[model samples]
Target: MEFEMIIMNLLNYSGEARSYSMEAIQFAKDGEVEKAKKSIEEAEQKISLAHKFQTSLIHSEAQGEKLSISLLLIHAEDHLMNAITIKDMATEFVDLYVRMSKISNGGC
Candidate 1:
């Protein structure tokens, strides 16, 4: 695969992950726990795909393949990092919402 295409794939997957994570949090806020969980699972799968692309780039660099640091590559990395951060926060938010629901229902 071309380097630029790999980066674009990573960006696409990361963007999907970010979007799913956001949707998961919104679902949680709306008290749709199952939908939120499903969204999180989908987001995780996308993140895994993105991570595979990232690992390939790292392996290529380790094999002495010199990759040009292009603006698009940097933007792709930003998307990946942002997606990771948002996923983490979304997970926490979902958990908090779940707990709040439980408390409100007198479960705990």
Candidate 2:
């Protein structure tokens, strides 16, 4: 694939992951645990796809390939990082919501 195409894929996957993570958080807030979990799973899948693209670039660079750095690449990287962070935080929020729900339901 062309470098620009790879970058665009990275951006697209990362953006989708971020959206799913946000949806997971919202679902958890709404007390829809299953839907929240499903969203988190979807986010993880997108993150995995994005990471594959990232790893391909890393492997290329390790083998003495020169990659031209561009603003779009930087933006894509930023989106991937933000998506990862949000996904992680969303997982924690989902767990917290589950616990709160249990507590409210007299589960201890």
How do the predictions measure up, each by TM-score?
0.97, 0.97
lDDT of each: 0.96, 0.98
Q: Candidate 1: list runs displaced more than 4 Å.
A: none
Q: Candidate 1: lDDT of 16? A: 100
Model number with the top lDDT: 2
Per-residue lDDT tens digits for candidate 1, residues 1-108, read 799999999999999999999999999999999999999999999999999999999999999999999999999999999999999999999999999999999998
Q: What is the lDDT of candidate 1?
A: 0.96
Candidate 2 runs further than 4 Å off = none
C-alpha lDDT (0 to 100) for residue 56 of candidate 2:
93
lDDT of 2 by residue, 1-108 (tens): 789999999999999999999999999999999999999999999999999999999999999999999999999999999999999999999999999999999996
- Model 2: lDDT equals 0.98
